[model samples]
Target: MSTPANTITENPPPISTGVTPQRLSTLRRWNIGLTILHLGQAAAMLILANNFAIPVLSAYTAGRPGTIGLTTSNLFDLRIGWAIALFLGLAGLDHFLTASFGRRIYERDLTHGINRFRWLEYSISATIMVIVISMYWGIVTINALIAIAGANVAMILFGWLQEKMNPPGRTITTMLPFWFGALVGLTPWIAMAVNISLLKDENLPASLYIILIVQGVFFFCFGLNQWLQYRQVGPWRNYAFGEKTYLVLSLAAKSLLAWQIFAVSLFS
Candidate 1:
């Protein structure tokens, strides 16, 4: 029996059959890009931190052979470098954990229990960063980071807890709170980036200023991407909040925090 024309017109074929080539390409690109960010950030941290050790240690040993020692001027880096390295290692671990999220999402395995635990892990990382920051500068903005980190803890524990039950279906327990935290965290970086962008030749050499501007652009782009991910655009448009988007956003936000929190310990 032939179907009626009106019925056939109303119920057209499904738009997608399976994962298309374009989607596979996008996934590959995302994986590559995230890996670059992970490794690049780690390398940058090591190089920048080691800047203090190289010349200062050489000078301290008065050009002795195979010398490795610290001096008064570079002591700040000594105090904080290890902590920064430790933090970077944790961040690197996040990259690996997040990489698995894509598969989990596809499997429809993203759960409220897992999300709450994820938030818990983030809270711990943020707390460690705060403690590390204290060893360098007692800046008031560090207090804001503290608040943000603490808020994540609260959101995971109080606001998100279904309490004594394995909740049904997929859910991001801490998505909205994390969005707010990310925005609030952007405050100091935005101000710094804009301020640095306005520096003149006398303030900093042209090349250095240009690098700073580039960093600013990176920060801005991260924020914009974050807004999209938060809204579940493109690859993120799954179950309101999906593992892939949150995973990438977490990496970006954590990288941003590392950039800001250790700015003085690093560059100075």
Candidate 2:
């Protein structure tokens, strides 16, 4: 029965609105329905393991099913496809698990929260990309793979050194090694772009060129995001996001790129 003016003696806040957070919680609480949706997506991906059952199943992967697919055809393509499927399925499981028991994960594994998506995350992403590329390239490009391995090792070291140098305060320490690794990683894409531009012997679908360029640009975006986050620079200083938001975004972008590149390998 008491109003804001009647209750307060000094600096009273605004009057009541539509619904407070406590009232909203009662109306929109997490329950079994969200859990089921998450699990259903995970289950649906099983269709990806078998390409022959339904031609439409390939739609989940958004990939072509010509001559080979899933675990049914060429050894190289199979391995590549298998990795992509594994990543997608595991990602679905992650969402389900997070939804069902995100609090525990938040308290335990995700303690660092948003700060976790820094150099360490970039290192892990770079390692995963290298592994996938190495598997696809195989023995034919052993020397080239070795060079890539060396570059990745240097990349990790740089990331580590940069993290160590980073102090508690959000001072602008523009870690050069991070940029160095980013530039180094672009070599393969640049080579691919150049070869295609010159009409070389390499055979691949035209759409793949678009994918590759987009993927390269995506990597650059990641680096820029990291730089912005590190410095809290410019317009980025005001932006805010929770730990889970960054986790899902980082996973989705990196996984989607991996999936697409792996799918394109089948064309080669």
**Which tens-of-lDDT digit does each residue in 20-68 have in candidate 2?**
3342232123323333443453344344433311011111223565634
Task: Give per-residue lDDT, candidate 1, residue 127.
Answer: 48
Instruction: Determine the C-alpha RMSD for candidate 1 after optimal superposition of all C-alphas.
Output: 13.3
TM-score result, candidate 2? 0.52
> Which 10 successive residues of model 2 have the least lDDT summed?
52-61
Q: What TM-score does each of the candidates earn?
A: 0.42, 0.52
Candidate 1 stretches greater than 4 Å from native: 1-36, 50-78, 98-108, 111-117, 132-237, 240-244, 261-263
lDDT tens digits, residues 28-111, model 1?
456546656766776777767634321111123435676676333332223455555555566555544544555444322232
> Model 2 segments beyond 4 Å from truth?
1-46, 49-78, 89-126, 130-140, 149-161, 170-174, 194-203, 238-249, 258-268
lDDT of each: 0.46, 0.45
Q: Candidate 2: deviation at residue 92, Å?
A: 6.2
